[model samples]
Structure formats: C-alpha cells, structure tokens
Target: MPRLVLEARRIALTVQHGLHGRRRAGSGENFWQYRRFIDGEPANRVDWRRSARDDHLYVREREWEAAHTVWIWPDLSPSMDYASRGQAPKRERALIIAFALAELLVKGGERVGMPEMMRPSANRRIAERMAESVVLAPRLPASLPPPFAPSPLSEIVLLGDFWSPASEVAERIELLAASGAQGHLVQIVDPAEETFPFSGRIEFREPESGDRLTVGRAESWRADYDLKLVEHRARIRAAAERLGWSFTVHRTDRPASELLLALHMRMGAGGTASAAPKGGGRAFVSRGPA
Candidate 1:
C-alpha cells in the first residue's frame, strides 16, 4: 500500500507540472480582479481603498472557491487481477490511476471520493486516504460500482476493464447519467487482450466464472476476437456519447501519466474530449445527439 501511494504521488506530481492554468471567477476568498462598480449595486460591495486611488468606484471579485465533488470508482473484481506476462495487473493499474487522479483533483480545489467506500473531501492527502480505504475494505469492490445518482454539480470517473456484457455496461452508464452529472469511462486494457498471440493448444479461463475453454489453435480465432472487441467498445462508446460523457481506453503497458493527463484535461473542459496522446489509444468525447 505504501509503495502504491508513493507511485501515485509521483505520477500526480508529474502531471501537475504539465497542467495549464484553470482559474475561474466565482465566490472565493482569494481576490481575482476588480471592475468598475455598476449602478444600483450594493455600496458595501465596492472596494473603497481601490476606488480612492482611481477616479471610478471599483468592486472586487474573487476567484471561484466552490469545490466540486468528484466520485471515483476503481474496479477490483477478480477479472481485474489478470495480467499478461511482464505487465502490471489490471487491478494495480486501476488503483494507481484512481489514486493519482484523486490527488490531482484535490489540488485543483475539488472534493474527491470513492462511490461507496469514501466521502468527498478536499484533504491534501487524498491519495493516501483512498489507499487506506481500499486496504481496509471488507471485501473486494465489484466490477461495476453500485447504482447511484450524484448531484448535477458533481462528476464521476470509473476505471476498469469494463468486460461486462454490453447491455449491462450501458445500463450502468445510463443510470449514472440520469442525474445530469457528467461522467468519464476509462477502460483499462491488457496487451494480450488486444493482440491474441497464443498459438497451438491453449486453455482460456474466465476470471469471474472460473469457466475454462481449451482451444486446439488459439491463433485461428484472432480475427474474430479482434472484431468482437472493436464492436463491444463501439457499443460502450455509443452509450457514453448518448449521455455526453467521455470514454477513454488505456493499455496497462502505457504510462499512467498519459491517462491522467487526458482525464484531467477532459474534466477541466467540462467533459469535452481533448486531443489524444502520441501513443496508440482512443479518447472519445460527445456532446449528446445532434
């Protein structure tokens, strides 16, 4: 757990340095700017000291200090434990991304929380807090977060392999989007899952069901497998698009920073799709049906 926290902090720091400014005007303690006082406005709102130096009365404005709530869920089901040779487990990568993202959100003055595990908070040590929660949980988290609707002011981020049935996945997404809250779906992929290199006799086991199937020549099914994967992804992507949410795919072999940066930028842009990273991956953003 300690090592995971350290790694998360490192990634968060790296992404923070590369992030651009996202300041906005709103009700906050810090002063943002001053403008000429408008007629019929409350006299007490004017900054007398500033008005004294200038010929015109001015009103001080403060930066937006209202913290937005962001709920994050990292799938820890048995399937997420699967990892290809020389690759990090899907579960580990999911947690790292979730923790790192929480840190970044907290630094931006947002409240971060896990759907059912934790409550929203702006604590600076958010990553550590989330890690501890995960370690002490009674049981492993489900592949899909429990169904719930958050306030419109809040946003959600779900990190998982999302290998669930297409209909089921779409239902969950629709349930969350019903509340009008913005959402992002990040599908973690393994290299082996994308490229089936297995040849000769091979036995494939279902992680969740413990079902096994032995194939005479696994390589014979590569083309069909790839097509199905693409079609499945398209269905999930369409579900998100229908609700104006963002969908991103990140391979476990890729740097976690790439996913973090893309996610952060998307959230900052109000769930709009940002430019994809240099490596091979897809980030889709939709504004609902035209």
Candidate 2:
C-alpha cells in the first residue's frame, strides 16, 4: 500500500511486459509432461483419460515445483544516501532495482529475501514486506555481506556502491562461494562519483566516516582519481571472476530496466546460475554513460 511498493510494482510490471512470459510448465496447476506409465507408479498420478486414448497407461509428471531462493541485500550505509542533482539517491536506486528484481523473481515462482533481514519465501506479500523493511530499517555501516552461512543452492544478489576495499569484498564473496551459492554483484553509483566533476576549492567528505578534506585545487587530482577508480572497480570485477559470479555496474541516472533486463536474461525464469567468464572478463553490462 505504500507509495514505494506501488511505484516499484508499476516499474516492474512495465518491464515485465517487455519480457517473455515465464509460463513454462512448472509445479503450478499447469500441465507439464505426460509419459508412458511405469510399473510401481502411483495411480493418482496416472492420466486415466489420456491412457484410455492409447493402449499404454500414461503418467503425468508436473514440472519441478521447487523454487530457488534469491537472497538480496541493499547497502543502507550512509554512503549509499549520496545523490547528485536531478538523480535519485544511490540508496533509492538500489532499493528500486532490488524491489523490482524481487517482484520479477517472485512472479516467476522464485523465492526472494534479504539475508539476515528476513527469511526467503515465495509468498505473494514478500515484496511488500521487503519494501516496508527498507523504508523503516535503521542505518547500517558500510560493509560487505556478513559471513553468514546461506543455503548452498540459493542465489545471492547484492546491490551497493561496493566502495569498500577489494580485498574485503573478495573475502566475503569467497566465503559465500565456498558454500556453493551463485551470486550477482550490482555496483550502483552516482554520476558524480564516476565523473568527479568538482573544480577548485572543493570540500570532500567521506559519508561513512564523516572525514572531510578540503582541496585547494580539486581539478589537479582528476587524473589520479580516475585511475584509482578504475583500479578499484577492476579489483571488484576480478573478485567476482575468481568465484564464477556475475558483476555489473549501474548508474543511478540510467534506466533501471536495462540492468534488470540483463539480470533476467542471466538468471531469469528457467535460467540457471550463470558461471564466471572462462577468461575472467567482466560480465556483459553497459559501462555507465561516458
């Protein structure tokens, strides 16, 4: 009933229409497959009418009804609250994508939840519960996913700026991958962060630590800053590659549907967990607009 939930559903539905229907035969009330009945089969599963049409008894097998849990986490740290003019806050963008992805996944009969925040469930109200939590949740420190043990077969989707040290990020991911879970890393950023478009006499502050530094000539550090930014992202990509996970960057300024579509293609309905590139190249994604 909240505005955020309503808006997220609208966005999701709009994108959903552009997407292919995930209506393949599954554990639902829909028909899946029929085959010749074998010995010792349960009579309840036999399609008597179909069997009558042929000499052989036919057994109906419903599609695999088991759904995979997709654990999603959005960074609620102070840094995620950053927003340049005319753009949604990084935190808001993360939530929009997270909620939209949850809607899509749940619609496809997959379960979704936030790690440590709630249990995974395919219940129709799951997205609403998640949206409420995000709206009312307390702030958390800027940190990587906690080293909690998760269902080995469940998938993990993390939405954040990932400004943390690469080593820390790699360790957390390695810990999860060791449990045999597939993952997708979505690095959400503001255009300002990428461009560093500040000029002379700028005061920059670290959102998490409240550390501030005044630079007399901000333009002088542009080259070095850009290089460091590239190196930082590369490390994150490399970490994801080492564990066979998918990594992509999304700018708050771009359409959320673009990244959402890519996600659906990679791990949507009937799509298995994607593997890391054989050559360790970054997974397919449009680099944020130049």
Per-residue alpha-carbon lDDT of candidate 2 for residues 46-101, written as tens digits (9 for 90 to 100): 89999989999997766445546788888877778888889888777777778888
Task: Mark the regions of model 2 whose C-alpha exceeds 4 Å error after superposition.
Answer: 21-43, 46-63, 135-142, 268-290
For residues 1-290, could you state the per-residue lDDT of candidate 1 as single tens digits?
Answer: 78888998999999999686456678878677899999999999999999999899999998676646899999988888878899988889999999999888877767888877888887889988999888888866676788986888889999988888777889998999898889999888777766666899988887766777888997887766666666777888888888888888788888999899888888845564523223433221010101
lDDT agreement of model 2 with the native: 0.72
Clashes of 2: 0
TM-scores of the models, in the order given:
0.83, 0.80
Decoy 1 TM-score against native: 0.83
Q: Which candidate has the top score in TM-score?
A: 1
